[model samples]
Target: MVEDYRTHPNLAKIKIVLVETSHPGNIGAVARAMKNMGLSQLVLVNPKEFPSQVASVRASGAADVLNDAQVVASLDDAIADCQVVVGASARMRKVSWPQLDVRQTAQLAMETVSADAQAQVAILFGREDSGLSNAEMDKCHYLAHIPTNPTYSSLNIAAAVQVFVYEFLMATDIKSVHQAEGYRHQLASAEQLEGFYDHLYQALQDIAFLDPSKNARFMRRMRRLFNRSQLDVKEIDILRGILTAAQRQSNQLKTLTQDRD
Candidate 1:
C-alpha cells in the first residue's frame, strides 16, 4: 500500500504516447515495458492494428496497461492537455528543436511534474518504421534521442519506449528549470496552434503572398520557425489579428484595382 502511494501519483502524470504505430505486437510490448517500470497511462494515436492476438500475447502478464490505454485520432489530441511534450526521434530534421539526451529529458519530466503537481508530461513515440514526421516533431517542446551507434541508430518502437520509461523511473535529484517566466499567456494547445496556422495560410493566400500550387512545404517551414518560438496563447491571437488585417486590406486593394480596370 505504501509502495502504491509513492509511485502511482507521479506515474499518473506521465503519458506514454505512441503516434501512428503500425504493429500490434509493439504496442503490447510497450505496455509490458511500462508496467515493468511502475509507469502506466498509455495513449495510442491512430494505431493501424490494435486489440489483436499478437499484441495481447506480447503483453505477457501486463495486460492491464493495454486494457486501460486510451486511443486518440491525432497526435495533437493525444497530448492536448500536456504542458510539456517531448518527442522521441533518431533522425535529424531541417528545423532545429531543443535537443535533449534521454536522461536530460527524463530529468526535465521530473522537474516539470514536480513543479506543478497538476502538470502533465507527454513522451511521444513515432511510427515503427520511419519514426516521427517533421510536423509531429514541431508539436513537441523538446526532442529527445537515445544515443546509439552512428552506423545504426534505428530502434524498435517497443525497445525505444522501454529505454525512455527506464530513464524516467531511474531519474533522481530533479530540480526545476523555469523557462517562459515573462510570458503572460499560457502555452497554446495543439488545437489552438493548428487554428493559428490555418489563419496564417489563408491570410497569406488572400494577400497573394503564398502560391498554393508552388508552396507545398512553405507552411511546414513556417511551422518549424513558430514551433521553436513556442508561441503562447496571447501571441497566437496577436498574429491572427495581423493576418486578419492583412487579408482585409488585400480584399480592398483588389476591389479598387478591378474598378480602375
Candidate 2:
C-alpha cells in the first residue's frame, strides 16, 4: 500500500526548497503543484514576499501546504538538516557535479530516503530571474536538469516544481524501490558538511596548498567530490582529525622556519 506522502515515514523527509523566489503567486502555484501529488514539505529561502494575498489566493485548495511552508534566511539554513541536495536548473553545466534528468533524480531521491527513514533529501529550485548562482549550486550534490525546447526554453518556477514533483511521485508509484544498497550508515547533513569544508579549507591554507578562499572553483570541485562520496558522520570525523593533525604539523614547521630566519 502506498502511504500518504505527508506521513510516509521516509517520503515525509523529502523537502522541496525554493531560493529567492520573487512572485508570491508562483509560490502559491507551487504549493498547489506539490499538493497535487502527495508531497507536502516545502521550504522557502529568502522569498521576496510570503503570506501575501496573491499567494494565498493562488494556493486555492492547497492552503494547508502553503501555510505549513518553512521560510528561512539562507539556502544553508533551509537545507541544514538535509543529507542529499539536488538543484533543479534548466541550464546545463558540464562541470564538477554529475547532471541527471528529473526522472533519474527522483529515483535517486527515492532510493536514498528508502534506505534511511531519518535521512532527508532536498530538491532545490532557483530564482525566477537568474536561476541559482554558482555559489548556491556549489552546495548541491547533483544538478537536476530538465531538457526543454531550444526555442524559448524557460520554465516558470511553479511549472518546473510541478514537473519535478510529478516525476517524484511517479518514481515512487511505479515499483517498490528498496533502501539504497548497503544503506547502513546515515549520511552527513548539509550543516556538518559546511563545518567539515571550513576545517578542510583552514588545513589547506595552513600548509599553503592553496587558499581555498581564493580558489572558489577548486573548492566547488572539492564540494562536488565529497558530496558525491556521500560521506557519513564517522567519515567526516575521521577526515577532520586528519586535517587537524596536518594543520598542527604545518604550524610547527612554520614556527621553525621563522626561528631559523
Considering every candidate listed, which one attains the maximal TM-score?
A: 2
Worst 10 residues of 2 by lDDT: 173-182
- Backbone clash pairs for candidate 1 read none
Off by over 4 Å in 2: 1-7, 94-96, 173-182, 211-214
Q: What lDDT would candidate 1 get against the real structure?
A: 0.81
Query: Model 1 — TM-score against the truth?
Result: 0.78
- Candidate 2: residue 124 lDDT (0-100): 94
> In the order shown, what is each candidate's alpha-carbon RMSD?
3.8, 2.3
lDDT of 2 by residue, 1-261 (tens): 444566555556779999989999999999999999878899999999998899999999999999999999999999999889999987886565778889988888877777666789999998899889888888898998888899989999899998998878777743324342444777899999999999988788778899546677778878988998989889999999999999899889989999999
Task: Count clashing pairs, candidate 2.
Answer: 0
TM per candidate: 0.78, 0.92
- Clashes per prediction? 0, 0
Write model 1 residue lDDT over 1-261, tens digit each, in one string.
123423446667789999888989999999999998878799999999887899899999989999999999988889887767889987776667788888888887876665555667899998887888877886787888888889987888888989998887776345455433532346666567778888988888888798777665787678767866766678889999999999899999999999999
* Winning model by lDDT: 2
